[model samples]
Target: MSTVGAQSRGVLRAACRQVGLPDEGAQPIRIAGNAIWRLPGGIVARIGRPDGREIAERELAVARWLTDSGVRTVRPAIADGPVLVDGRPVTFWDELAPHRPGTAADVARLLKQMHQLTPPASLTLPPLEPLTKPTRRIAEAGLLTTDDRRWLQDHVGQLAADFAGLPAGLPAGLPLCALHGDAWDGNVAVDADGTAYLLDLENTCYGPPEWDLVSTAVKHLTTATVTAAAYEDFCSTYGMDVTSWPGYPVLAGIRELRMVTFALQIADEHPHARAEAQHRVDCLRGRKGPRPWTWTAVP
Candidate 1:
């Protein structure tokens, strides 16, 4: 096991002990960024990094808010605790039963529903800060050469400016509301009966609906991760095609940059991610030319 994996398991064990849940037979769900384990009794425990307590608390609150608003999301298993275990924050969720990744249309409909609701006055969601994580990752990436790091930072600065000064912000008729922040087919799960539920509320925030739509647009337009037909279905269901909007290139650029930096952030801890991280950086540096770059999905 990688160092991160071992450390996460230790934290997971400590957390499970605190919650009176058994650590035996706990299956790892994912081990990057956050360590997720499917525990016994239909519970999913997500163990975040040491400094992630605030974010974990926010995630719990966001889940509660979404559920209260009648949005079908992964509900919090324990309402009061983002239990701190050995400094790592752990949050428990009610695991879904036999679900597959949601289709693009499912993502669209769910996002549309989320974007329309007014967050209750008590829920104080932070405004979207698109460049925060990517910029930090780029600066901290040990694998990048000096030149590569400089170039990526410069590119991030330019995109940040473009996003702030967007000529026609927020699209035509949409008002800002709580966005799924990382909206995409992958972040949604569809159950056996085809009911879709949103997952990963850590990034949920008050933001432009366009920010939420841009991920789907990039999946089709830039990375081609989703099929053209699926992209069409998403737009038809959501009532807007984000790629057609004038401000799209800027948001798409930001999204792609985030993907690249995210890969870099994990490359050191998980060596298997290094080559794909390099590939993504190369694509951005114009080695691979333009849009529709063949970017692989990394866990």
Candidate 2:
């Protein structure tokens, strides 16, 4: 297997030339450990190994779709319709400015706007949204225990019950917004002036707009109470009635499960990040504290 570093060098070299940026053999500004590069010209290029084609395609489509709704992301155009770069699939990005700190408000407002835009159902069908079984990916990708898998099946099985008591008439059917699917902090960039832009949107899926809230919340839960609070502040600013989104808490359950699945996959390479994923999973499983959703004993 070609190392990510080797494949990234190839992509950046070609992408720099393609995008009219200096190719002086673009130096690797950052490596993704897997599937990415932060290269020269402030470009963020995503690499697709043969095995990672689905990831490449999903990111391409999702980022393209989300870009239309005015979400700041590195818009991807095909590099020769899936040609090989150093024997790996390659996609180039338009450089985006950095994301600055103290811009939680910007983050909140942009996220709110993106969430309010509905995803086209056709996005799920084909040519636009190629469906990959994420559960299967998480499972096969080696990120969950036999116990974790079974637990997820059981917990997600109760999703209907999960949303049972949300107040009715609260933000029901507000358009399903375009999501970053993978909204972790590392994938965000702040420009010199403090503008926030999203990167690596390979997991975009259409669902209740509430899904974006869960994505935005989970990472911050571990690190930033103030950022978390500021996120809540966005709801009112965006003209969203706070009570309207009944699915936030429940959707969090599913999102947490996925986070576990990711953690398991990277336990070896990213032990700390994996541990955090496990902790969040434990919290949601009610293993650490109140499983907030239970509200009462599981009937």
Candidate 3:
């Protein structure tokens, strides 16, 4: 199920009753690591909002495509070409049972497997939502302290790329895959039993496997061994293309910047999150690499 508002949730509850999936009420569940009250028995009946209609269509389509490719996902419902609840758009899904793991190795590998799955050629999706604009917003809004801006700025020159040698177009007939644009840790969920379910496909799009990988690297549990081993296991399972690393690594900085930008927009919603976002910018600034780890929207 997706996120929903108060009245929208009521409208969906009615729809569920009409469809024979009568719900008692929403039992509070932590979906996508966010507190959402999904209908007792229906996932779609729980979400409310029209702003996500276009995105919902894409995410549901990609979810089906990925399911066919052997990835475990929340199945989107089919309800007479999208349902309306008090003017808000709502989608349904079967409640997924997942297990959360304490370490990054397990989570990273799971994400890697999903990354390796190939999507149908006809599946044309959206563009990569880079981190540059978001970060710029944060800067302009006075969301960051002077120190943090300086930190992100220091990374600017270092991450610049040479576009001269870039390929004119993607390979003539290489397989493309369904990509989770905002494949951050918050989108992952683990049930008490230890199974994982990737969530929040609103940012789903069509792109390289790295679109998922670059963000997956920022783990709750940090360890180089876990990072390397998890990726190694994924490579062994999927035989990914590593020559793409140099490129994805640089792109991840953009992700960092994007994250900073998002924080500014939502910082008011949660105090701890705002503090942590600012702290994260500090962390990125301290970590030195061949390229700047701050956001860049060049592509």
Candidate 4:
């Protein structure tokens, strides 16, 4: 196991003990941003960063809200919201059964449903703040040089200004609603019966619907992770091609910046990701030609 995995496992064990769950058979699902473990008894545990208490709490609330709102999403486990173990927030979820990664169509349909629902007055979902994660990563990413850091900070500032000055409410003519913050195929799980369940509620918030569509557009146009055909299906299912909007470039740029900064953040902890992170920074700095530059997933 990597250092992150080992340390997170230790945290998971402690968290399980506190929550009265058996940790002996816990298996790692993913170890980036958050450490996800498949615990015994059909429950999965998500262990977040040291300061992630609020995020965990919000995620649990979102899951319940979605469930109550008639959206088919992953449900929280029987335990309480989140328990702090050595500063890390740990939340448990019921594991999905016999699932595969959701298709582009699945992402689009689910996001459409999510975008139409009105959040209850009590929920108080935060307005979308795109700069929070990337700016924080750029500051914490020790692997970046002084020049690189300055350039990224300037780029982020420009994007933020552009985003704030959009001619209309975000994307120029759409009503805002609750958004699945990181809407993508990876965040949706499809079960045996082809039912889609939304996962990773950490980024759920109130925002323009276009923000949710940008991820698929970036995958298809910028990174080539999603094929053109799949992207067409996504746009058709969602009933809007976000890339066609006038404000798309700005949102796309912001998403690309977030991706690059995330790579840098991962490189700081994993030596193997250093070269890829530097490559991403180079691509962003115009050393690489243009869009469609390939980016390998890190961690």
Q: Candidate 4's residue-wise lDDT over 1-299, tens digit each?
A: 99899999999999888878899978999888889999989999999988889888989998998899888998989547799988899999999998999999999999988888888887878889988999999999988999999999999999999989874645444788898888888899999999999999999888778889999999998999999899999989989999888888998998899889889888887889999999999999999988899999987
lDDT score, residue 78, model 3?
Answer: 60
Q: Which stretches of candidate 3 lie over 4 Å from their true place?
A: 1-24, 30-35, 42-50, 78-88, 101-122, 132-142, 145-176, 184-196, 220-235, 240-244, 285-299
lDDT of 2: 0.54
TM-score versus the correct structure, for each prediction = 0.97, 0.66, 0.65, 0.97
**Model 2, range 1-299, lDDT digits (tens) per residue?**
23545656766677556556565635554443345555555655666545656666666776766778677766764433343455556666766654443344555566666666666665651221211233554456444567866776666557545555443533745644455455444556778866677766666665455555555564445323335466566555555533345555565556656555555554534444565556655666668765332111100
Model 1: CA > 4 A from native: none
Two-way lDDT contest, 2 vs 4, winner: 4
Query: Residue 71 in candidate 4 has what lDDT?
Result: 89
Candidate models: Cα lDDT each:
0.89, 0.54, 0.54, 0.89
Number of colliding residue pairs in model 2: 10
Q: Write down the RMSD of all candidates, one decimal each.
A: 1.1, 6.8, 6.6, 1.3
Question: Which candidate leads in TM-score?
Answer: 1
**How many angstroms is residue 104 displaced in model 1 relative to the true structure, after the best TM-score fit?**
0.6
lDDT of 1 by residue, 148-265 (tens): 9999999998998998897456566887789889998889999999999999888988878899999988888888888999999999999999888888889989999998999998
Point out the worst 10-residue segment of candidate 2 by lDDT: 290-299
